[model samples]
Target: MNKVLLIIQREYLTRVRKRSFIVMIFVVPLLIFAMGAIIALVAKDSDKLSSEQVVNVVDESNIFSDKFHDVKNIKFKPVKASLEQLQVAAKTNESLLILSIPADYDKKNVVKVFSKKKPSLLITDEIGRQMNDIAVNNSMLQHHIDPVIVKSIKSNIAVNAVELTDTGAKDANVGPNMAVGIACAILIYISLFIYGAQVMRGVIEEKTSRIIEVIISSVKPFQLMLGKIIGVGLVGLTQFGAWIILSVISTKIAGEAFNSPQGSMMGALAVLQTIPFGYILGCFLFYFLSGYLLYSALFAAVGSAVDSETETQQFMFPITLPLFFTYILSVSVLFRAPDSALAVWLSIIPFTSPVAMMVRIPFGVPGWQLALSMFMMVAGFLFTTWVAARIYRVGVLMYGKKASFKELGKWFFYKE
Candidate 1:
């Protein structure tokens, strides 16, 4: 235990003292903010571009009783003369081109688009299309089409979302689900990237600098591996807690900046302040740590298995496949049914539940279900850590030889 503590202290302090870590902890968040702002600004310009498009709506349906001001970004030109007059005006510099709905337009036939030249991008033929559809649909209705089917076809479909609670008086909203899902995803991505890379770089550094010899002299191989994994995992958590604090502060400031629309801050703070939050957040922190430990230990095993970065990729994606696949499927199914058998089953799978459970929790899960999920996660994490330690014990000493999946599996079964 003392040896493990020494290893943890060494790993944590070494990483914390590095300039790169110092820079990244501060710079990355600012970069994220800048990128978000730039995207918003570009979208604002795109909205203005939609307004810039000038389309002359020539309604030749002749049944037109009112002005066409309701058409978005469309200009209405009521024709007093022939279609010939409009075509002549269309050829002018007023607008690049035009699509004219003909007066003789048969409702059952193709609508004709009259243009002197090909329509420029600044011109939209959407109004022309909509008018043609309206005319055709009007014809169908005039022929007395089935009203029931017509109404059903035109009606909007909505899915009812509700939470089944045992005793809680309050109901869950989509806002919390969305916020928690997004937060959980962010946490998972950051932990995996940060800790996984730490494992890789640690292996590479030890292999290159011959520091493994000194470390091996003092502690057993698996003990050393456990220490490094735990130490870095702690570093990950410390930074994660700091980031959560910073983000909460940022959210508060943003709310003030934006006037806290619909009492968003108060609602968020209210939820955070609840007594159950301690348990919920405790579950989050524990699962996050355990999940990272499981994955990062394997990353260490992979790093020790390989001599260089190029060879590392061959092992990395296969490891992350479970995390990515689980997250996608969890999010996809959360809307269809958050409490279904599928959701219930997935949240129990350890590799998946780090993300899957977090997404489902905001929607509410039964007590036994949450307990079972935590049990599976802890058990799975312990099992993976043991396997990784065995791999590390052997692979760390091996030099110049590449480790194969088959070879690694063989190591796991070896009687040491």
Candidate 2:
């Protein structure tokens, strides 16, 4: 145990002291802040930056004669020219579009748009909305019904989601919950690959350089593998913790500098307060460590089987496929249907549970499901570690010959 701890300390200190690691720890947060500031400034001046577009209308029906109004950078003008003439004219005018409404527009409710280039969806949608409103209002007037009454009856309802707990009902912030859930899942996904790859690379480097032979003389293969995985995981935790602190500080500074209205800031704060960040953070740490352990053990096995990084490619895909699949499912399906059968199954499976469960957590996973997922994750890592140790003990000393799946199976079954 003490030997394992010593290996862990050596591995942790060796990488964290490197210049590149230190540089990235401080530089990434600054770069992210700078990019955000630049985007905000550009968005604040987008209207001024955009050129005005002219839409010439040739309405044969004349119903929309006075209804067309200018909005944003788009100007609508009523014109008498034929459709062909405007189409020809539009070729030379890059910012000009022609909207031709047929004589039977009310009956057909179809309008043709021609432009030198394809018109944006925003312009098309706006024009369609206006035309639909005009047709509806005209139809209502002809039937002696008031459009104002109909409009007044259409209410835009806002729903407040409240989750009932055994203790009491608490307000649920759906947007923030989804945002935080997806964010945590993504973070775990990236960390697993990054730190797991680091373990594999470290193992390969030691083996290739003949350093492992000397190190193996002092410690058991399982201890060396476990120590390296845990040490690198601790490094990941340290980097993540630092990034979170830096990001929070940077966000606070930016918020103060931007000087948002107090009411809006308070409203944002209220939304944030309902997100259950403590629970999410706790889950994130658990999943990150367990997932790292699970994948890194496989990574270490792959690394040991090969004498070089290039040889690792054959073994890497099988280990990485589950992580990739889970990430896609978590994004595409889990967010929309956290309680769906597919999501429930994905979250319970040990191979995918780390990412899958993290995504479902913010949406309020059942206590039983969460417990089951955690149990599976723990079991999954332990099982992988045992298998990896079996492979690692033999593979670390192997050289001059490439390894195959069949050979790895042999290695796993070899008795000590």
Q: Give each model a TM-score.
A: 0.74, 0.85
Q: Could you tell me the TM-score of candidate 1?
A: 0.74
**Candidate whose TM-score is highest:** 2
Summarize candidate 2's per-residue lDDT along 262-376 as a digit string, tens digits: 7555566667877777888898999999999999999999999998888888999888888789899888888999999988998988889888888899998899999998999
lDDT of 2 at 365: 86
lDDT of 2: 0.89
Residue 71 C-alpha lDDT in model 2: 89
What is the C-alpha local distance difference test score of each model? 0.72, 0.89
Off by over 4 Å in 2: 32-46, 58-66, 88-93, 100-112, 165-169, 247-263, 307-314, 398-407
Name the best candidate (by lDDT): 2
Residue range with the least summed lDDT across 10 consecutive positions in model 2: 257-266
**Cα lDDT, model 2, residue 224:** 100
